[model samples]
Target: MEAVAKALHPDSKEKRYCNNEIISISKQLLVQVLELPFDSKSRKMTDLLKTFDGLDITKYANLVSQKLKINQDIYYYDNEHKNYYRGLQVMYQQENENDKQESIKTIRDADFEVIPQIDILVVESIWEDNKISHAFAIANKQTLTGLKFCPHCNSKAFDPKDKNYSRDYEIHIIQCENNEGKIVKKVKLDYIQKPFVPHIMQNKTYQYLLSNGRQHEFKPTQYFITYDLETVPKIVNKKFGKSSYQMYELFPLSVASTIRNKQGIKKIFFSQQDGEDFIVQWLNQLFKEAEQVNADNQYITEACTIDDTIPYSMEVPIVGFNSSRFDISLIISQMQ
Candidate 1:
C-alpha cells in the first residue's frame, strides 16, 4: 500500500531504495567527508560534487534526499566578477525559497532581509584560464543601491540653512547586506583609503619609523624585513651562437616573507646564492606560515615548474617567487 511504502521509506517517491540502503549511503558520505583534509568551511555543495568526481549530482541529490530526509537543489555562484561561489546553486525546497519558481530579479530585488540563507562553495577549475586566481574565500553579497555621490563635495558643505544655494554633492557608500541588514550611510571614501595596501589581497606594507630620536611603530602589519641574497637561473633559453658575445649571466634573487605579525612586516630572507634549492627552502617556510590560515593547496604550489616536482606529500604551505604564474601554471598545464 502507499502508506506502507511511505512509512518504510521517508523520502522514497518510487520505493526503489529501502531504508537500510539509505542509511548506509548516509554513513558513507559522512565518513568520506571526515577523511578529507580539505576545509569543510571552504567546501561548497559544488565542491562536494567534485569530491565524487564521476557521480552525477542530480542522481546523488536523489540519494541524499531519501537518505537525509530533505529535498535539495544545487546552484553555483560565480565569484570571479563578484564574491561567493560560482556554478549551480543548491536550494532546499521545503525550507528554502526555491520551492516556488523565482525570477533572478525577485531574488536580486528582495530586501536584503528576506534573502534566504545561502551556502556558497568555492569551486576549482571553472574555466581553462591559468592566470585567473581567486584571492580568498570571500563570502559577501553584491549590491548596487547603497550610495553614490559627487567626489568634489565635502560633508561640511551640506547645511540645512542653504536651501536655495545647494551644492551638487554626492557621497559613495558601502551599500550591501551587513550583519544588521542595513545599508551603510554616506561617508567619505578617502577616509578608508589606506596607502601601501596590497591592492586585491587585503594585505598592506607597513614600517617602523625612527624619527627624532623616538621610535614610532606605524600600522602593526605594515613593516618590512630586509635580507640580501644571490640569484641563479630557474629557467634558461638555449640557442646556438655563431660568435662569442658578452651576456648578463646570474641575477640576484632576494627572498622575502611578508608576515602579518604585530605589524605587517616584510621578512626578507637574505642568501648569498639564489638557486632552486634556496628558493625551495624559503618556500617551505612561507608555506608553513600560510598553513596557519588554511590557504588552498593548489594555489600554494602554483609556481613549481615541470622540472620541479610536487612533493609526494604537502608538508606546509609554500611561498615561492613567481609561484602563482610559473609553478601553478606549469603544473595545471601538465595535468591537462
Candidate 2:
C-alpha cells in the first residue's frame, strides 16, 4: 500500500476538494469512494489503490479513520513521520482475510459455475490511397472453422486464417489496388478518412495544376515568402489588481524575408534603424507581396472551358520555424 501510494504521488498533483458542509465521511460516502455497489467483505488492496489513484491519501486516510473511530496513532509507521500509513495495511489485511473465508464457502456451494471467455474477430480492409475500412465480428471459439479465401487478394488458394481461432484475432486485407490509383498493402496502414479525399483532389489550386499538367513540379508563376524575426528582451512594468511588477518582454529588433518567384529570388530586411515602428512597415510590405502573388497565379476560365471551381480563393502562407512561443507573440503584441 505504501509502494502504491508513492507510485501515485506524481499523478495526484491536482488538489481534491469537498464542500465546506461535508466535514466528515459517512458510511454511504465511504462506499461511494470505494466504488463498491454494496457493503461487502470482498475489498481488495488492488481495488483500494485504484480508488485512491487521484486522491490525497493523507486526507483520505484521516477521513476513513474518523469514520471507523480508529486511533490516528496506529495510522502511521513508528518514527517514519507521515511517510507511511499503517492503518490502511491493517484494514486491507482484515478485509482480505474475510474475503478468503467467503471464497471458501462460495466454492463449496454446488450451484457455483465458472464463466467462459468470449472471442472477437477484427477484420481490416486495406485499400490504396490511404483509406480507412474496418469490420468487427463475434464468433464462438469452439465452433469457428478457418476462413476459406484470402481476405487481402480475394483468392481461395491463399488462406490466411488460423485453424484454431479460439482467441481474439485481427486479420488484414493486403495487396489490393483502391479506386484512388494507389497500391494497397497490409504493411502500409496509413488510414485517411473517405470524405476528405474529394476535397483535396478537387481543390481549385490542385485542379488548376492538374489541368495544365504542372501538378508534379513547382510552376514558374508560383511564389512563396519565408520570413523570420529577431527579438531582444526589454524590461516593462505590469499591473495585476493592485500589484505591479517588472518583467522582461520580447521586442522585435529586425525582420527579414526571402521571396522566390518566376523572376528570381529577392531578399528584404527591415530594422529599428529604418524607423521606430519597422515591424508595421514590414507587415504592410509582406501583405502587398502576398496579394501580388495571389493575383499572378489566379486561374481564369475561357468560354469553352468548364468552371468546376469552388468558391475559394488562394491564400499565401507565412511560415516561421519555432516562432509560435517567441517571435509570433512579439509580432502580436506590437499589432495590438
Candidate 3:
C-alpha cells in the first residue's frame, strides 16, 4: 500500500491519513494524550487501514484547539486561529496545483521558441540545395522499428448466451509485429477481465483529478497499466470471511497496480470496493484522448472512444500461488 501510494503521488511527502503507521500514531497520540477508548481493543493495531473509518480524529479536535492556544506564534491562535481553517484550505489548493504540475512534467512555452511551421518550408526548400538535414522530414517505420502492440484480439463473451455480459469477457491478445513489414512475434500476452468491479465514478462521483485542475492525457502506445484483483471467494460453506471478504457476491474488493509510460510518468492506484474499473477505464480514455488530434496535430484534450491506432491495453498476471488455476480460471471461465 505504501509503495502504491508513493508511486501514484511521487511528490507527496506526508504520510497518508490511512497509512498503518499514521493510523497507529493517530490512535496512540490521542489515546495516551487524551485517554481515549479506555479499552485495549480500541487501539488501532493489526488493522489494514482504510479511508472512511480509519482515522477517528473527532475526539481530539477540541484538544488540538486547546493546544494551539499554548503556541500563539507557531499556530494560528486567538484572532489568527479563527482564520486557520481557511488558511489550510488555501494551502491544500496550492498543494494540489503543485502536484499536478509535477505529475505532468509541465514545460515552459519559451523552450519551443524556434521558427514556426510556416517558415519550415522555406528552410526545407534550401535544405536539399545546401545538402543539410531538415526538421520537417518524417521517420519511416523501417528506420524506427521497436515494440508495436498488436491490435488483433480474441475477446469473446465468457457466457456467449449471456447478452448482458460486458467485461465478463476474456482478452487473449498477442503482441506481434512486422519488423519493417516482416511478420514476427515480439511478446505474448494472455490476459482477461471478468467479474469486473462496479464502476467507481458511476453517478455524481467526485473526480479527484478534474477537481484539482488536472486533465488526464497521454500519448498512445507510450503507457501501460499492469494490474489484477483480489476477489471474495465463494468458500466451501459460503461462510463470511474477513476485511476484503464479501457476503453477497464474488466481487473485486481490492486492487493495486503501477501505471507507467516511457515519458517517466508513473502512477499507482490502490483501492477497495470499486476502484479497478475506474483506473482501467481512465487509461483507456487517456489513450483515446491522446489520439483525438486536431488538424494542427495536437491532442484535442477531450474524452473519446477507444482509438484502434492507439494501443489501449491492460495485462493481468497471476499474483499468488495457484492463482493461475483458481483466480485466473474463475475470471476467464465465461470466455471458455
Candidate 4:
C-alpha cells in the first residue's frame, strides 16, 4: 500500500502523473472497455481484479525498507565526511582573517593630515566713546609691516608702532594720514593675544557696547513712510508655437500707507476705483507726498527736548517689510 501511494504522489519522479495525462489515460481505458460487447463487461472487470490480487505486497515493502537502511548506514560511516567538514571550517576562518588583516592595512595606510594652526592678532579701533569699529585680523606679529593702508581714509602711507606688549594684551598705536598726506590722527587699538585657541577676545569697548547698546542716546528720523501693496491674480493668455494657454499673473490691486511726520500719524488706502489703474493712482499720490515732505521745514530735537532742535534735511526713507524684492520692484517697473 505504501508503494502504491508513493507511485500516486504528485512530486514522485518514478511514477508522476499530471491532471491532463491522467484524464487522457482514463479516457483511453474507458473507450477500450466500451468497444467490447455488452456481455463481456462483467468478465473484463473480473479479470482486472484478478491481476491486482496476483501482486506481492510483502516483497515491495521489503525492498523499500532495505533501500532506506542502506542509505542511512552509508551517511553514518562515510570515511571522508568529517575531514570535508573540517576543511570547510578552516577555509572560512582563513577568509575572515584575511579580510580583517586587509581592513587593518587600509586603516594604517590612510592619510590623516592635521590642519596647521594660524596665529592671528585682531585689531579693534577705538573710533568713538564706547564704540569699536573697523576690526581686522593680522597674521603673525612679524609681518605687521605689510599693513600700509589706513582703515579710516584708505591712505597708503601710515606708521604703526607697538604701544604696549604684556602677557595678556598687545596694544598697537597707528598714525593715520589725512587728505593732505599729513599724520594728524593717532588711532589706538586693543589686541588680545591668544596662542592656543582661535576666538574673538572681547575688549573694554566691546563690553561697554554690550551693556549699553540700547541705552545710547541718538536723534530719531522725523519723517518716514511705511507702506504695503496688495496684489490679485489676473489671467493672462500666452502663445507658444501656435498653442495658446491661460496662466494667472499677479497685479497690484490696492495699497495702504502709514505716514509719520511732525503733525501726527495718518493712514491712507488707495484702491482701483471707477476704472482707474491702482498702480498709476498710487504713484501719483506718492509723488505728491514726497514733494510735500521735501518742501516742509522739519527739525529733529536733540536730547528729547525742543530747546535743542537741529535743522535736518535728508531724503525721507520709505520703509516696507520685504519691499526690496517685491513691492519696490513693482513700483520701479511702473515708473517711466
Best by TM-score: 2
TM-score of 2: 0.35
Error of 4 at 103 (Å): 45
- Put down candidate 4 lDDT per residue, 231-315, tens digits, no spaces: 7778887656777677877787778888776667777788777245667677777777766564343432455444222233457
lDDT sort, best first: 2, 4, 1, 3
Per-prediction TM-score:
0.18, 0.35, 0.18, 0.29
- The 10-residue segment of model 3 with minimum total lDDT is 115-124
Q: 3 or 4: which has the higher TM-score?
A: 4
lDDT of 2 at 225: 83
RMSD of each: 27.1, 23.3, 34.1, 35.1
Q: For residues 1-336, write the lDDT of model 1, one tens digit per residue.
A: 111122224443565666556545543454442454543344463476466434344334444343333323233444565533233333333334554435445657775314233222223454566422221211222222112222222111222244442432222212222314333467676766766635312321122122222223222222222223334544344455796444434444555565443334446473436554555566566556555423222222335432122222223333445555334433233231
Alpha-carbon shift of residue 146 in model 1 (angstroms): 60
Which numbered prediction scores highest in lDDT against the true structure?
Answer: 2
**Which residue runs does candidate 1 get wrong by more than 4 Å?**
1-252, 262-266, 270-276, 291-323, 327-336
- Model 2 RMSD in Å is 23.3
Which window of 10 residues has the lowest lDDT sum in candidate 4?
Answer: 83-92
